[model samples]
Target: MEKKRILITGAAGFLGSHLCDRFLAEGMYVIGMDNLITGDLKNIEHLRSSEYFEFIHHDITKYVDISGTLDFILHFASPASPIDYLKIPIQTLKVGALGTHNLLGLAKDKEARILVASTSEVYGDPLVHPQTEEYYGNVSPVGPRGVYDEAKRFMESITMAYHRFHGVDTRIARIFNTYGPRMRLNDGRVIPAFIGQALRGEDLTVFGDGSQTRSFCFVNDQIEGIYKLLMSTYHEPVNIGNPTEISIKDFAEEIIKLTGTDQKIVYKPLPTDDPLQRRPDITKAREVLEWEPKTSRTEGMKITYDYFKNLPEAELYKKEHRDFRSHTKG
Candidate 1:
């Protein structure tokens, strides 16, 4: 029997690297792609020697060229963190818009199933809590974070256009906040930020009175939902995340307990356009893909904390700002 061939963009990033592991476990020939912009090579370096794994060190937004047939394409490439997207705003927009288009084109040529990784940010300080797929969203097209949000919005739009007009098979996963091992300590998301602070004996910084809420999914749970979505026939977007939401202040407290640190929680003004609340309504996911998150926060956090704790001392203090002067067109 022939093994399925799969191409995963952003294959060196946190979630992307995990997806590569999942697919390879299923006996697929995996091709990993990344520009090393926000992704660290160490994430996928262990897979380099695998006979079934191949890597392409190229940016998807420029032009994508693969020689053989691909059974599936997972478009997970983008500067996913606020710290990253903010530093490379234009590149973030390009990857979501142009990078998605390029992958969609490749999927069409190969007649392959393609899934583009969408985000909860499309809800945009959502007027509707526990967001569902039917919501048209309340995103600001010109906000400071608009580059990433709008670009993903455009990604979903063009993807559907290809499906509807060009007869291409497409899937969209509207992912919520997810964290686990391999996450950069300086990614600036709440989990890593809080964990990093607790580890360094610094105060956990909470923005906007520490009242803003977010729901987090452990990486394994999230990847399971995504894998099920790829195998299912449902074509519309589906939400994949844990429904148990937590406030920034409370979450910081949990981190302090988990890390055994006496760090205090400190408040700061929230960044502009930061969502006041985020939670996903996974009714469609449950009914269609029959999926829900399985990892408990206590269980997941311990695993994630241990991964970061064992890292080199230098990584804990590293900052992730990218220099765009050397940025490629992708």
Candidate 2:
């Protein structure tokens, strides 16, 4: 039997690299694509020796061409973290909009099944509690964070259009906050940021009194949910995340405990357009995909903390900032 062939965008980033591992484990030919704008080559370096794995260092926002038959396309590109998107907002918008469009076109041409990774940010400082697929969302198009939130929203809209009008087989996974090994310590998300500070013996910075809530899904659990969704015939957007919620202040304390650090918490004003609460309503996922996160926060956090703790001392103090204007069109 011929092995399946899969294409995963953002293949050198946190989530995309993990997807590459999973697909390769299933004995499939994996084509990993990334522009290295925010992705690191080190993440997928280990897979270079595998005959089934190939890497393409190309930006998807520009024309994307993949030769040969493709059975699946997992669109996970784009700067997923606040630090990344805030610095490269235009690129973020293009990947979510133009990049998605390009991939959908590719999927149509190849007659392949495509799954675009959406985000919980589509709910956008959500007016509804525990966001569901039915909610329209409360996003501010002109806000600083809108670059990510709106891009995802537009991605979903275009994906659905392709599925309906173009008769393309498509799936959307509205991912929530996910953390684990390979997470960049400086991505500006709460988990890695707190863990990095604790490892460095610096005070954990809590934005906005640390009252805002976010639900974190372990990387393993998130990958499982995504895999199941792609195999299923569901056409609408599905939320894939652990519904375990925690406040930023309390989460910092948890990190302190895990890292065995004596660092105290320091408060700072929250960034504009930051969500005060974020939790996914996964009833649809449960009913359709029979999926629920099995990894508890305690277990997941310990693993994640240990991963960051073992990294080289230099990574602990390094700050990653990129100038994306040259690569991104105005």
Candidate 3:
């Protein structure tokens, strides 16, 4: 019997690298694609020796060409961190819009199931609490973060259009905040930022009085939910995340405790359009995909801390800036 084949974009990034591992573990041939714009090759370096894995150094916003039977395509490309998208907003927009279009077209030609990685940001300082699939988001298209929010919103719109019009098999995973190993220590998300600061013996910076809340899902559980959604027969979007919510202030305290650091919490003004609350209502996922996150924050954070703590001393103090000039296009 021939093994299944999968193409995962952003394959060198945190979640994409993990997805590659998961698919290969299922005995599938995997093609990992990335442009190294925001993705680090180090994340996928360990898989280089596996015959089942192959890495492509290409950006997905341009055309995508894959050989032979492509059974599945998980579109995980794009700069997910706020620090990244804020710097390369245009590139972020292109990957979510043009990149998604190209992949959907490829899926159409190859007759493969495609799962596009959407995000909880689509909720956009959501008016609805515990965001449900039915709530139309309160996004500001012209805001600073709108580059990412609108891009994903457009990605979802076009994905559904393809599904309804061209009969392409599609799955949209509206992923919430997820963290674990291989996460860049300076991605500007709360979890890694707090952990990184704790590791560096610096004060944990809490924005907006540290009152805004975010629920985090462990990477393993996030990957499981995504895998289940891709295999299921459902066509619409599904919320995949842990509903365990925490405030920034409290979460900062937890991080300090986890790292055994005596760092104090410092407050700063929150960024514009930052969501005051975020929690996914996974009723659809539970009912349809039979999925719910199993890892507790305590368990997941310890594993993540261990991973980061073991990194080279230089990584702990690394800045968040990157040069996107080589990858950016006009």
Candidate 4:
């Protein structure tokens, strides 16, 4: 079979880089595009040697130029974190709306199947315990986190619009808390934040009594589910995440144990609009795509720690990230 040509936007971020690696390993030609706003070249620098991997510095909100018939499109580009999106709210909005629209246009031109990376966040501090794709989210459009939440919601609407109106092949994966290698040390996501702090022997911070729950799926499992969904027949938003629910506090303590850090726990004020609870109902995923998360949080953290631990001494971003964790062990 002839190899497929796939274009991935936000191809430099944690998940994007991993997707590129997966595709290239399968002998596919991969084109990676990123603006480097929240992504770093170091994450994907190793892939430069692959003859099938190509990287371009371009913003998705701006016009994207490409040639040849693309077989797949993964629009993973967006400011995903609260801190990052809060810092650059407009960019997040533009990427979700304008950026996604442009890519749908490209998909039309190339006659390619496209997957827009949606999130559990679209469910907002969900009223439903284990969020399913059919559950309409309880989100606040005027909340502090509105920029990202609303942007993602808009992306879903437009993606469906393209699918229904233009007959564009589309897939939407409502991704949950995914953590593993290549995650930015200071991206402010919980897993990396805890690991960085524990590694540096600093206090770990848990917000709002540390009772907020989340389900974590390792990066490899996430990539696998994503690849399968793209090739499968499921089209509506599918929840892709582990079903094991752990509170933020318990998760922090586990990281401390894994890292062998005797760091104390510190109580920090929770961020505005922080989701009270989040877990994915992967029942549909298992039934339709025959997909279930294979990596445990403990095993995933160990692997992730090994990668960050291998970083050079001069990589002080990890060092500075220690400041975020408090000493409270709870």
Give the deviation of candidate 2 from the true structure as CA RMSD. Answer: 0.8
Off by over 4 Å in 1: 328-330
Q: The CA-based lDDT of model 4 is what? A: 0.87
Q: Is candidate 1 or candidate 3 better by lDDT?
A: 3
lDDT of 3 by residue, 1-330 (tens): 999999999999999999999999999999999998888999999999999999999988889999999999999998999999988989999999999999999999999999999999999999999999998899999999999999999999999999999999999999999999999998888888888888888999999988899999999999999999999999998999999999989999999888899999998898999999999999999999999999999999999999999999988887866787766666
- What are the C-alpha RMSDs, in order, of all predicted structures? 1.1, 0.8, 0.8, 5.3
Candidate 3's C-alpha runs over 4 A off are: none
Q: lDDT scores for all predictions?
A: 0.93, 0.94, 0.94, 0.87
Q: Model 2 off-target regions past 4 Å? A: none
The alpha-carbon deviation from the true structure for residue 262 of candidate 4, after best TM-score superposition, in angstroms, is: 1.4
By summed lDDT, the worst window of 10 consecutive residues in model 3 runs over 320-329
lDDT of 4 by residue, 1-330 (tens): 777999999899999999999999878999999988877788799999988889999988878778877999999999787768877777788889989999999998888999999999999988888888899999999987988999999999999999999999999998998988888777788987887787777899998899989899999999999999999976799988898999999988898888888998898898878999999999999999999998877788889999888877565253323222221111
Q: Using alpha carbons, what is the TM-score of model 2?
A: 0.98
The TM-score between candidate 3 and the true structure equals 0.99
Worst 10 residues of 1 by lDDT: 321-330
Error of 1 at 122 (Å): 0.4
lDDT of 2 by residue, 1-330 (tens): 999999999999999999999999989999999999888999999999999999999989889899999999999999999888988888899999999999999999999999999999999998899899999888999999999999999999999999999999999999999999999988888889888888888999998998899999999999999999999999999999988889988998988888888999999888998999999999999999999999999899889888998999999999886677786567
TM-score for every candidate vs. truth?
0.98, 0.98, 0.99, 0.95
